[model samples]
Target: MPPTSVAAPPGAVTAAERSLAPDLARGVMLLVIAVVHAHILHTLAHGGAAPSGVADTVTTVVVLAFGEGRGYPMFAALFGYGLASVYARRTARGDTWPATRSLIRRRGRWLFVFGILHTLLLFFGDILAVYGLIALLFAGMLVRSDRRLLVWGAVWAVAGTGVYALVNNLLVADVEGATQVLAHPLTDIATRAMTWPAMAPLLLITSVFPFLVGVWAARRDVLTAPERNRALLARTAAVGIPVGVVGGLPYALVSAGVWAAGPGTATATGWVFMLTGYAGGFGYAALIALVAARMGARRGPVATALAACGERSMTSYLLQSVAWIVLFAPYMLDLAVRVNGTAAVAMGVGVWAATVVLADVLRRAGIRGPAESALRRLTYGPRHSARGAAAGQPAARR
Candidate 1:
């Protein structure tokens, strides 16, 4: 435990203090997330149709290999990174560990609330609540020794992977049968409400390993100072990405109908896919950091726009959910029945591109994302200033 010295809590990080790599990684991550969620929702609405055309087959293969099971781990890792940053900043200002933990838990509580609302009102596959539960449960673990963090992370990785494999083998059919088209908003909300409780805990389990690894990386300032860790980052990208891609190949082949296998073989490949996804997620982050390092201070319009979207990630994510409802819901435009995998992916990309433009507009206007602003207020109280003066830093713009 850290020393029990009390001090004023530090304020939020200013744009100047924010690192490009983390933001850029998040910005790109949202695109992956958008496409994955879009694909999954489309599949569900279509009652899990098999690939019917060349384009659909290609889409299935590529998405299975590089998209599905990849984005969430990266999101979890970044969440851990943010948590560690909060701990470091507060501790550096002489805040007690207990107080810091309370602050984190409080934030978690609100995140859980957000998740619940998101589930009830929009997407049923919301991860915000799972993240909230994780923060609530493991806030104390943030202060554990580096050795302990890695050990426990490994333990969860194995346990969670096994559970995922079992669930995949046992419940794949059930999941496919449980197609949701939002034909009735009330029915959909009730269904999500009933299932979210069970799903949230499982997600927390599968997510903890990557989250802990992220905390470990943050302790060493991995993303924040990519230049200092270029060699390590390079190696991680080199090894992790290929391993992830190769591991995903077996499942991708089966999913795309390019290969036929027994149920047992398919199940085994599913396990392999989930297990190697951690590598893919980490590799993506490392690769993005390397790119950011190379760019240095030269912020082009595209990079700047991406970073802006990343900074406002929560809003961007929620916006995608809104799009899902508008575009796919049976009660809405109901495009899911008409669109194929390739078209759905294209639509996902278009939605993400729209967000990038909107986020850049907000950046130029000096307006914080509405969701971000609300979360900051909930986490730090309405009266809390964005200024870091309590930590002897310059005033920060919100």
Candidate 2:
């Protein structure tokens, strides 16, 4: 395969020049993220509920099949993929390793700051901080060979899974107790902030493996060169989805109370379920890329809208939490107490749809998402005159 070309200077690529796959994948995955989070918030609203009614059972099964343990890893893999691409672009443009690393470190540092604020103000399960921390630790590994990247990824996955299993044994959190903290707005933020010291470790451990795999994928330029890697993408999707679903099935059954298992066995089994998402994440990416390769420049309004959402994913992600707070927070609409599993899922979809529309509007107006603009400004400073020097281009947008 020919070596893929680097992207245009940051802030140079307009909507017309943007690739379809990565953005489209991000757009589609936001819906998945919204649904999984909706389920979490819904569980909190109810103070917890089993898969009882027909609606709950169906919704729970759908989540088990595709939502839970699936979306986050997929997004994490994409995060790594984009991070690796940025590193490649910078180095290929003649930037020194030290300078390139500094660029990424600055970006990651800002992301962690954003994540902290997002968690304290909106959602405790903020992933930006975890991604930032992990990227800071391992972004340099993108320069490693493919074989080394995959080998270490596998190692991290196994070791991290073990760490999670041990943590589960040592610190079994009371789900009910955590949910109750959301009963009042003032206490909710404090309680969620407090849980982070414990929750962050688990998220970090579970995330590293997939993030590494994403870096490996970026080395191949899969998203940028989708036309060159159709067979690989198809094979990944063919194998990943079923394996992820099967591995996750036991946990799904256990979650819905359709299967009986000892607590220790369940914890171990949950680890297995989480690990399979590594495959699922790759599969989702490959499938989306293949679709984009076929679509080419023929995308219509809906596709354009989705790609726009993906382009502005950071903003969309934050906005999703704001929507959740408005509808479910006790100090807000307080609808969590009145909504069921089916209703919550519907609401999540509604919120995601709104974001898609908003993203399209921003694109039409030739505006960047607020968060994306802020991040670009922070990472690259004010855009200088286009000097056309490889060394002078703005940093690649994450």
- The prediction achieving the highest lDDT against the true structure is 1
**Per-prediction TM-score, please?**
0.93, 0.91
Clashing residue pairs in candidate 1, if any? none
Give the alpha carbon lDDT tens digit for every residue of 240-312 in model 2: 9888888888777766667777887778777887888777777887899999999886877788889889989
- Stretches of model 1 off by over 4 angstroms after superposition: 1-11, 385-398
Each prediction's number of clashing residue pairs: 0, 0
Model 1 misses residue 23 by how many Å? 0.5
- CA lDDT, every model vs. true structure: 0.84, 0.79
lDDT of 1: 0.84
Q: List the residue pairs that clash in candidate 2.
A: none
Candidate 1, 1-398: lDDT as tens digits: 12212222363665556789998998999999888888888888877756778998888888878977888888899999999989999898898999899899998999999999999989988999999998999988789999999999999988897777767666655666567665888887898888787677668888999999989999999999999999999998998888888998898888777888787888888878888989999999999999999999887889999998998899999999999999988888889878898899889999999998999888776677778778877888765534322321221122
